[model samples]
Target chain A: MIEVSGLTKRYGPATAVDDLSFQVRPGLVTGFLGPNGAGKTTTLRLILGLEPPSAGRALVHGRPYPELRDPLLRVGALLDAGAVQGDRSARDHLRWLAASNGIGPRRVAEVLELSGLTGVARRRVGRFSLGMRQRLGIAAALLGDPEVLVFDEPVNGLDPEGVRWIRDLLRARATEGRTVLVSSHLISEMALTADHLIVVARGRLLADTPLAGLTARFPTLEDAYLSLTSGHVDYRGVA
Target chain B: MRRALAAEWIKLRSVRSTYWTLAGVPAAVVIAALLALHASSLYDGASAEAKANAVVSPLETVAAMIAQLCLAVLGVRSITAEHATGMLRTTFTAMPRRGAVLAAKAVLIGATGLVAGLATLFPAYFLSRWIAGDRPLVFNESTLSQDLPSLLAGASLVALFALVGLGLGAVLRNAATALGAIFALWYVLPMIALNLPAPWGPRLGAVMLANLAFQLSGDPPYPGALMLSPWIAAAAMFLYGAAALTAAALALTRRAP
Candidate 1:
């Protein structure tokens, strides 16, 4: 379980995440939906303890993230797929991360196979294509086989097949009773994968409802999201 | 802590730059040896009267400074490279205790420095001794036993550079800025110290890293310069590393990634 309460972040004079409170329970795919500049990434950073919160606190499994023992074994995250050391091979990259959390090299090989990266595991990350990088990122997130998984914009550079792979992966992880939080601005993508929807706009919570609950009242999830976040869109192209 | 250490060990070896930096130690010794050969040639060419006045400073001494620079670069690359590549976020996410992670990195970086120091300084000692070939160089007058203390102190200084570079890297978070400060300290500041007015010149010079090994080993860099007692010089060396590390620790733990 992940709980965020009264969480706020301010950079200088501008507030990024403001007085937000929410809970992500286990056994479901919780889509963290927001438009651009909606503070989705900042909130995730706070929850991961990458940034100290300005106002409140975030709890994972009833304790703060930093306070947890073997954090990677409990919480796995893929914040940015391209944030790897390009000089390292994909296998070596995972091996170090595993070593950090006391996981064995066998798990590194396992994730490489699971992500279908065993063929290119010996290649340097700098030479990987975007799709390959995404796969490597996913492999890292699953390195520990944690109960809580967080993915930020995981499908941004994927092809149709890659997108389908992500959708199914998230669903499968959630089915195993793990808590999954995936953030994206694409409503259509969330419609296929998210069991619960937590929508926000302008750094404020707009809706925290189940997928079935919101879909029943609107023609589509996109209409429901647009109507709810009308003034909060910040920028839009002309029709 | 052990896990972090193990992980960092893997990190330290996997990067190609680490090997490149270690490779520099032998390469630096070779360069210094070539310079020594040139000095040896000059000494032989001079007339009998002029030969007595000519001096060749130990080759190991010259090479030690270069080795320190290489290790400092190694230290900076260990951390700042992660910052540049954005791998620090992933590291922190996996192990959120920023202090612990920083400590782990410092431990490995310092170890690399020690190994690098031993590798370069030891070989240069024998090579310089061999190259001088009874030419009666300034350092050649002393036997290996008499020079071991200074040589060990020199190796310690190299490790100190690694820590200094690492601390600056964390506090500065940019390789260019950290490396610039390191260069200024290692290369530029000692020259500026010598040009300063009396008392202060030798005083500052005495504390400068270039002079510490000599002073700590009971042989000041030069005559008439302030020569701190061996223990005091060692203490000063310790303080340099401690100050840099403390500053880096605070910088790393107090701020956001």
Candidate 2:
């Protein structure tokens, strides 16, 4: 389980995440929903200990992430799909990450097959399409087989079939008693994948409710989201 | 620490840049042989008085210098490439002990540099001596046993370059910027030190990184003999590397990915 409390992030005078607090429980696919510039990425970064919070703290499995011994064995995260060395082959990329965590090559190969990246395992990431890179990122996240998994905008570049496959994979992981936290700006996507929704806007929590509870409140989850997030969006096209 | 070291080694070996950068070792040996050929010919053509005055840079020194540049580049490439690509997030996420990761890089890069340096310097030392047989070159004046300390000292410079490169890469976090900083240290600092007025030139020049290996040999360094004792020069080099890595760890851990 991942716990974040009173978390805030400030970039100079601008507030990126403002007094945000949420708990991601085990055995559920928790959808971290926010519009663009909603501080979704910043919140994830704080929880993963990539950046120090300006206020409060984030905890993974009852301790801070950096304080954990071999943190990969406990919590696996895919914060960014593009955050990979283009020159490194897919297998070698996974090999080192596994080595860093004391994981062996067998798990690397397992994750590769699991993510359907075994075919192109020897190819450089530079030649990979966005969909393929996303798969590789997912492969990396699953390498440790940790109890908790965090993914940020994981399905962004996936095709329809890829999206369904990932949705099923996430649901399966959550079903097997894993704590899964997935962040996405797409409401409809979350509607199909998430069991619970933790919605935020302008770095502030707007709602934290189960998917059934949210869907029951309005005509559609999208309608509920738009109304909850009205005037909180940072950017919009002139329509 | 062991796991991090293993990971870092895998990272270095997986890339083509490591091979390219370490190519300096073999390249240095070949260059030394070529220079040996050039110098032996010069010695053969010269009159007795001219031959006595003739000298070329020592073989081990030249090879070690080349290896140092290459290893330094290897060190810089190791970290800066990760930073440039945002792969550091993944690395830190896995390892979390950011300092340990940097330390691992330092150890691996430093060792690789040292190995490359020794590999180049030893071969060049022997090969140059053989090629320039009975040529009365100044570089050939010392016996191998007597020259052993200087040869080892010269090879150590390669390792220091790699460490310095790693530290600079950590602090700078950009390949181009780190490379520029390295070039400034390797080339520009010595140039400026040489042109400084009065006693400052020799004084400053004595501590210059390029001169340390020469000083640490406990022999009067060629080109210009730096006055520092060998032990002091070794200590100064250690301090240089430690300072760079310390600054790097601070910059790397403090900065957000």
What is the DockQ (computed on Cα atoms) for candidate 2?
Answer: 0.90
lDDT of 2 at B141: 77
Per-prediction TM-score to the true structure, in the order listed: 0.98, 0.98
Docking class of 2: high
The alpha-carbon RMSD over the true interface for every model, in angstroms, is: 0.7, 0.7
| B212: Cα error in model 1, Å | 1.5
Q: What tens digits encode model 1's per-residue C-alpha lDDT throughout B105-188?
A: 889888888878888888888887788788876767888899899889999899999999999999899999999999998978
- Residue B222 of model 2 has an lDDT of 44
Worst ten in a row by lDDT for model 2 chain B: B218-227
Query: Which candidate ranks first by DockQ, i.e. highest?
Result: 2
Give TM-score values for chain A, per-prediction: 0.98, 0.98
Model 2 ranges with Cα > 4 A deviation: B222-224
Q: Specify the highest-lDDT model's number.
A: 2
TM of chain B, each? 0.96, 0.96
Clashes of 2: 0
Error of 1 at B7 (Å): 0.7
DockQ of each: 0.86, 0.90
